[model samples]
Target: MSYVGWMIFGVVLLVIEILTPTFFFLWFSIAAFLSGILAMFGLNLGWQVSVFAVASTLLVIFTRPIAKKIMGEAPRKVYVEELKNGVATVVQDIDSSKGTGIVKISGENWRALSVDPKKVIKKGEEVVIERIEGTTVYVRPIETEAKKEGEEI
Candidate 1:
């Protein structure tokens, strides 16, 4: 192709790369621009293709890691532990032996269960929210510790 033709192709590809916002076409556009430069210098088809390939490969391989570092790592979603504790209301009777229940905390309902198997809690009883296991909240009877401090047992 003529020098002018190659330059026009390069410019079109570069514009397309900009519109698409992907780094992929940008490399090929750079290659095409280099090919156009080679054409302007009287290089033939075989030499132009070789230069474009080598330059594009080197640009991608050298720049990818640097680009990743500059962009930084993708932000991860916050875990459930980040939310406040001690504010959940029992939505279902938590049977420790049955191992199933639900609670509503911060306007979001969550599956819940007693962490201890021996404690049997009734419905409408306020409980302390404990650690999360998967999507379930593991709970214990509230004031149990305080009650224990006052009594012998």
Candidate 2:
């Protein structure tokens, strides 16, 4: 094919690649352009097809890893230390051994557990969130005696 024909094919494929965003079909288009280059060099149809197929396959295999590295890992949603040592009020009595209850923290109610399963906590009591397990917060009674005096309760 002529150089102008190959350039047109390349431009059309690139446009399709942009519209679809699949990262596929674009390779075959690139292959066609490469075959066009080979054709310009007077390669026959069979040789041109072979060169295109090999070049396209190599492009895909090599570009994929580079693309992933450039993109890096997918961004992960993170929950900060919002609950760590943060105080929560028990909204429901927690029987840790039986495994579930609710606590109200920062105006949001969350399922809770006693990090120490041996303890049973009562409703309306303040607790310290120890850790988060999935959506549930594990907690323990806040030590109040240390601040029982004039230390802000």
Candidate 3:
């Protein structure tokens, strides 16, 4: 292809890169622009193609990881101890059989359910929060904690 063809491809690629950035095609667009420059200097078409391929590959290999580190997803971490064994008061009856309940912990109301399917926790009862799953608190009655202490899970 002519230098004008390469230049057109380069501009189109750049436009696409701007619209939806992946930190990927921008490098190839740069290679296309460079190939156009080489073509403008009267380099053979074969050399221009080779240059575009090598430059695009090298840029991706060297810079893609750096860009990903700068832009990659940062996942929020959850600590188990922050929720485990925390004491909570049942604000509404927790009937695991019906898959419903409510509790209050640290003055905040929360949807709750018993870990044991057969268990039903009564309102106003203090229960130990075994764990939190999303917005729901899984708990067991504190009175049942002795023989099942920690096994309150």
Best by lDDT: 3
On TM-score, who's better, 1 or 2?
A: 1
In model 2, the number of clashes is 0
Clash number for candidate 1: 0
| Residue lDDT tens for model 3, 25-111 | 899999999999999999999999999999999999999999989987755554546767999888889998888898988777889
Of candidate 3, the 10-residue stretch with the lowest lDDT total is 74-83
Scanning candidate 1 in windows of ten residues, the lowest lDDT window is 76-85
Q: Report, for every candidate in turn, its global Cα lDDT versus the true structure.
A: 0.78, 0.82, 0.88
**lDDT preference between candidates 2 and 3, better one:** 3
TM-scores across all candidates?
Answer: 0.45, 0.43, 0.48
1-153: candidate 1 lDDT, tens digit per residue: 877887887789889878973466677778888998999999999999898889889888888677668768856654687643675678888876787788877777878888787776676777777788788888877766777888865
lDDT of 2 by residue, 2-104 (tens): 6557668778988898897467667868887888887888887778768877988998888767766776776554454866899999999999878768999
Best by TM-score: 3
